[model samples]
Target chain A: MKQYLEIAKILKNTHIVGPYWKLKLSVSELAHRASSGQFVMLKVDSDQGPLLRRPFSIHQVKGKTVELLYEVRGKATEILAKMKAGQRLSLLGPLGTGFSLCDLSYVPLLVAGGIGVAPLVFLAQNLRNRKGLAILGAQKKERILCEKEFKATGFRVKISTNDGSRGFYGRVTELLEELLAKDTLLRKKAFLYACGPRPMLKQTIMLSKKYNIPGQVSLETHMACGIGACCGCVVQTLTGYKRVCKEGPVFAIKELTEEGLAE
Target chain B: MTPNLSVVIGTLKLKNPLLVSSGTFGYAQEFVDFLDLNILGGIVTKTITLFPRQGNRPPRTCETPAGLLNSIGLENPGIKVFIQEKLPYFQKLKVPLIVSIAAQDEISEFVELAEKLDKERLVAAIELNISCPNVRHCTKKSNVKLIAQDAKATALVVKAVKKVTTKPIITKLSPNVTDITEIALAAEEAGSDGVSLVNTITAMAVDVEKRRPKLAMVIGGLSGPAIRPIAVRMVWETYKKVRIPIIGMGGIMDADSALEFILAGASAISVGTANFINPNVCSEILRGICGYMIRHRITSLERLRGAIMC
Candidate 1:
């Protein structure tokens, strides 16, 4: 449970390795306590022009800071991009149960779709041995974000583009399937963690279930308070309705029922 | 240096006048990360009833032009769970805790819930939530005068609860009244220590494509910046009419907006819908007010309170 923090600075404003539309906000705050899949809500306007803050997954957390990766969608993100250095941002964060990979012993498999690649980068860096592979997918080769960042972490990287302009002319899951077919050992000990769009998460969770691989995926909802109050961001669970901010942005594949996913 | 951000709401001396209203702040425990709870005057927990309420069905909330509409129906863990699970957390908080109590059917249930709260010394006060405007027939009747009568009856229960504990009783008022001052006066006459005004105006949203009510509950309470002016006017009128202290609130997302409430005769102010817009609105308001005091050379904050010239 990370408290609300003030943004100390707006560090680098570089686009990801691929020509993807995703941008990263290098916020100055040590969300080390923040796990792989938790998120932070950023106030887009200081004057209260926007009636609600925006929630984004913690893509990467370096020393004394956390990185937020998001695409320019709607007016909020566009306003966020216009923010400059030294402007204070009231941020509510480290919210939701982030990805839990602490129990897994062997190498891990991290998957992301488009802007979904945000959280997995932090997850890979968190592993002590760099003991995992990252599979990233986007609509086209130019749309893939965070390619070089994942590559620099010393993990095996695979890219898939829908237009066949990149490494594989298919989805990231196809690459994962190819890797699994080639290396039987890879599938035995590795655990999977994915965060991305709703459709991609639904498909990935299904595939993980079919393969009998233990996996977790971060869920998305419209969060109002970001705390447990309001219950604006509720996700149906096996037990009952749980807040996406309190119970998760991440849940085990088995925790969520089939009906819970947006079909 | 500014004198102090302290003010009196009834007999309670708060460190500051900024508080988070019920339903928006949840229990005090949830805001431990981003907020300095001790710095706040108090925290009004979400409305609790005799039994656990699942609240209204979702799409419980929708954003309006400058505000939000919610039919949360006061969802809570009930008094028993609140006492068992939520009370200990409030005890740990550095700020004063004001439990917002609500009920259904019988007025005796309000008495019972207040009675249960009476034993706890951890609470600084109780903000009676009789102004729930979301659910149909939630109140005794939709009439403002009837709402005032109900508030009087509820205040009698609070007075009884006050006997068990010395904590002040603050009755929160609904905005659907024909004259908010009448309800404010009724609460004071019934022995309410102080009062908070503007707990969401009754409203409905349109599903234009479907040509029907947008909310599942058919109607919801409107809050946020859209209703700030109405809240200010009502608070101003209530302050003029009532002798007791007033805690004014409505769409108060910033210090300037909150100042308007204080100027309009609110002894203290609470942040409601603004919390949804910006998580730091409370602290920002606090800082902003302090800055205003310094910049304006105001020696004391109370001197500026209810100084609405018009």
Candidate 2:
């Protein structure tokens, strides 16, 4: 897809859940061009203090509007949180390879942990016609995000919280293992996809491999350019070092090494 | 009437004065989908060594106030792979291709790399990257000192590479030094055609909460708008000491910054960290420079070079 650099007007900026801020932007070109799992490099401020552009996944797209779910992590995000509606943000994107949804035979299963649900929400929205399952995980009930959004898509949504305050008491991977073991038919047709913290992703990859199921993962890394130029976000894959920004924020289960999964 | 933006660095003549800094613009192919390669003054390939380097471990980069600290460790495919796999792609480009090469501890390795690249007719010039702050010399005696930090070592490497290739040599110097002019003079005396300064400043960042270094390598090189003034000052100092041309780079984000380098006495300027902010930044900078020239009615950059009225 073609990328663009345009100033997007902030349509809405509100706190979604604990620590998560949802930003809605009016950028026609990017809203139409961006696909599931693609991201934009957002310039938070015009000043030199927070100079580097921070990468944000396209949370949702409706006509000329795009949504981004971010947490206040550092100086840049702190600046981004203070932005009010009608403010303009310089955005460069529709960049990097997005999630591939070509196979029609397998059952789509989206597994997410905490804020990693950002891109999966976009993925789930695009799979409205397909009968899929979403396993959303968080530290506690309050941290579980996009459960309503995923369920609204007419997909089976499962919640897992570490504190046992939600649907499942243990990790998402354990719940996945239990579900996969009980459904023999699902074991054959399940196509697992995940995005989350390193430990969760590694466990998910391990579970996927044990079941011999086809899977894809969206990765996160500290980036500079978000394009292939910087080489800052490289992850060691089976094929060697690959830029997580350009080659992927998403990769197939087999393409990554266990080290990459942990990273 | 258009202003003359073309610049001559040593034996090579560029169509303009906006070369993309090495390492920032990967082998020239990465930007093809985003920009027309022909518009650039030149393309400098990433620094290559005699053998493949698998760079530093993860968390290689961290964003500072207006800068970026990177400990990439010069990860590159060895010279052999670059010639066989990468050079052909650069050869097809319409603009001049300057190859940047770095050596471990031995000067002979630098000579070997120069000899191998000398046969490639597509190479417009050779840029010796003796000042990369990311990698340290493995030799026991060198004690991890960067080659550009010592004038004698810089001269020896330049003279060794100069012996093998007729291609104009441009020594890329580091800013993390006491006197940059001494290094520039040494390179010029050793038969370097021109010089490019300054490579990223050696720096470190900390995650105060975690109480650890941000990068795995502990210290990396700093680049961005933060280093522009220091780079301009170094260029001015180096320009006064050396007769050869100067390619000034460091925190060059726009035409104004590029012009600052030119006015401070850089014959040419490179856009580095700004390329990360905007992929089309180089072209914008080129146009900005042209617009400034048209407004000032300065027909040639030669008239304005070093015209900084003290």
Candidate 3:
């Protein structure tokens, strides 16, 4: 998608789960052009103290508005948390490659871990002519995000927590295994899409490979220029080291190297 | 009336004084969809080496207060691939194209790359990068010592490359040394047409909890608004010593900062780290420079170059 540098006006910044914020922005140009799995670089403050713009995945886009789901990780997001409605920010976006919605023949399954649900929620919203299954996981019940939002999108939602306070008392990968084992039809027709920490993604990719299914995974890294100029966000892929900012924040499961999966 | 923004560095002429610094601007293709590439004075492609470099491991960059530390280790597609794959795209650009080259220990390698690029008609000039601090592997050997840090080494490399290429040579100097003016003088005495300073300051950040360096390379180059004052001071000092022109860079974000470099005695300015904040920054800076000239009723940039008062 084409990139744009725009002044996005904040409509609301609301606290969702612990440490999570939903910043709704009135960015018609960016909203109209953004697709699922794409991201925007946000300059949190007007000053140059933070220096670099922070990259956030496009959580949800409805008509002329877009929502960003982020955690207060550092100074930039901390400043974003305090920003009120009517504040303006410099946003550069619809950047990197997004999830492909092609091939409707396979059943869509979204696997999200903790804050990785940001992009999956966007994908769920854009899913048409199909009812997908969303497997959401967090450390505990309080850490789980967007359960109702996923349900609102008409997705069959399943929850897992490390503690026994959610639907399944185990890892999301284990939950995915159970679904595949129980439903022979799902094993044959499922196409998985996942986003989370590296360990979770590796496990999810391994599970997909084991089940003989096709899947895509969204990766993250510390980036300087989200526009591919900096080459800072490179990941070692099967082909070679590819820039996550340009080639993908999204890649097919087969493209990633599985050498360090045990770690 | 539109102010005459054009300036000449040696035999090479630029449309304006605004340039996107090497490394930060990539190949110039990355910003084409966001801004017009023809509006700027020139474009400096990232530093190219004789051989392909994989660069450092993960955590290549980190942010400090108003500064950025990067240990990219000059990751570049070697000269052969650059010519075969990257040069075709740069040749289509209307603006002046300055290619930055980084050499290993051998002066022969520098000459070889220079002779190869000298054949390309699209190349307007060559900027010799002798200042990169991120590459740790080059530090062990005396021959591989950063050329900018040693007067004799700097002269040797510049003289060798100058012998092979007719293109204007601009030596990029490091700021980590004790005296920067001495190195700039060395470049000028070695037949360099111009000099650019300063490459990122040698600095390091540490993860206090982990008790380890933030960058995989242990130390990286520090850049951003934090280094602007030092850049201006070095340019001002170098201007007093060198007869050749100075292309000043380091932490330039906007027009005012660009003007600061010019007034401090830089003939041209390059916006580096700021490009990450705004892709259209070069155009914004160009317009801002024009507005400053029109408001002050100045017709040319010469009136402002080195116009600072004590």
Candidate 4:
């Protein structure tokens, strides 16, 4: 509820990895309350089409600046990629439920796939536990992201690539299975947290159940009012359809329907 | 140099003509952080129903060229819970509270919901949301009919609700109908205080690569700048047909578009999709309207209302 609508100036818009663009905005109030897994809705400064504001997960916040990592997807981001520094963009944020950092007794893990790593970097930096692990995955080595940033956060970094261009070949979920399978202590004490493609997060849920570990997945859907209003960006759950914008961009792996990702 | 921006709908008076449209504005609480709720002439709560609805499946919305398609089938707490929980917040907001309500095709359900809201002192008026695309499917008949789609049905619902509630009733109309003025006139004849139109147009989109509909509801309501012209035309036509006030909406992003509605005969304007893009849009739009009125030296909105040259 402690949200603000502020016009943010882009301080830097830079390329980091394949299809990944980092947008840093100088909107202190917006950055002040933002937490990991919380997102900001960015409006295209131009009166250009796509009419609605695009939601982006809070990637990182340093000092008074907030960073958003977005993939150049569709018309919105394509226009966003061409944006330069000093250009003012309207932002509504620190919106939605964010990942909760609790129970330091459990082993912490950050699992991200492709650009899904956007929010996890901020989570990784803020997570209270040391000796945490970050599992990063992408299509290729060139596509892998946030390895150094995660490493800098004092967390162990694991990598996977579909094309075998990175540390471990195969889906990140495969590497996660192997990691949890070999170590009974890791399986029992580890708490998995993930945000990625639906198939990957869906598999993560399956693995959490297989190992009896608790996990959370940050979801993305087509959204209009990034607040609870529009009733768009909903996903089916055991209770009913819950808005991804208000109830969560983050939800417990257990609360979702088995086929919740399909729609 | 501030021009009088106040407007009225029925006995309900407004400080300004800018009310944040329901659904997009979220009961006025979600936007209290962005702008002062008092700045709005009124704020319409999300459409509530007689019973709690889980709404449609996932993928309820999809973005399109210059617009958005939504199939959120009026997911809301029933009137009982809405009054118990959500209605309290409105007491703090200085703006007039217009509660939008939807129900099954049953006129009784609509009447029951309106009666419940009528008891609340905070309720300034009730917007009959009989135009939603989802309402079209609620009928048991195969031919699909939204209450707002048929003149008689629109009249029946309006008259029944009107009889039960002493509060002003604004019948919301759909653009999907053949001639919107027919239904607007019907609502007016049935004793509706005013009419708000056009609701989202029935629309669809396809994910070509996946060969699937983008929305789980396959067909959703289209809103935004894409439907503005059609809405203006409908407002103009309805203004000519009905004596009741017209609350114009459809892709109204700024003052220019809002003024277009007023010139086309809308007594007031509601900002919808634009609120999703900029939470403070209502205030910005209100500012823009005052700026225009001062420039044109138009002392009253009445002069501008239906002042279209054409």
Superposed on all Cα atoms, the candidates' RMSDs to the truth, in angstroms, are 4.3, 2.2, 2.0, 1.5
lDDT of 1 by residue, A109-133 (tens): 8888888887788777776465578
- lDDT of all the models against the reference? 0.76, 0.88, 0.88, 0.88
Candidate 1, residue A238: CA error in Å? Answer: 1.9
DockQ of each: 0.40, 0.60, 0.63, 0.85
Which tens-of-lDDT digit does each residue in A1-263 have in candidate 2?
67888889999999977789999999968889999999999987756477788898888999999999998888888888889999999998888898988488888999998899999889988888688999988889998898889888877899898989989999988889989989999889989889988888888888888889988999888899888876788888888778889899898988986776544
- Give me the runs in candidate 2 sitting further than 4 Å from their true place: A261-263, B138-144
Model 4, B95-182: lDDT tens digits are 8999998876566888899888888999999999988885443476424478888888888889899889999999999999889989
lDDT of 1 by residue, B1-310 (tens): 8557787766677888888999998886776666667778888999888888766655677767777888877778899999899989866667888899876655566678777887888877888887888643334543432243355564555566566556688988888866778778777877788989889987888879778676667788899889999999999889888889899999997889998998888889999877665555688889999999898888787888779786
Pick by DockQ: which candidate is best? Answer: 4
Models sorted by DockQ, best on top: 4, 3, 2, 1
**What is the per-residue lDDT of model 3 for residues A1-263, given as tens digits with 9 covering 90 to 100?**
57899999999999987899999999868898998999999997756468899999999998899999998888888899999999999999999999998477888899999899999998988884377899999989999999888888888899999896979999998899999989999899888999988889888888888888898988877789999898877777777667888899999888986652222
CAPRI tier of model 3: medium
Correct interface contacts retained, every candidate: 0.57, 0.54, 0.60, 0.94
The reply for model 4, stretches above 4 Å from the true place, is B136-138, B141-144
lDDT of 3 by residue, B51-110 (tens): 998777767888887899998888899999988988898667788889999875565777
Poorly placed runs, candidate 3 (over 4 Å): A46-48, A181-183, A258-263, B136-144
TM-score of each: 0.83, 0.94, 0.95, 0.97
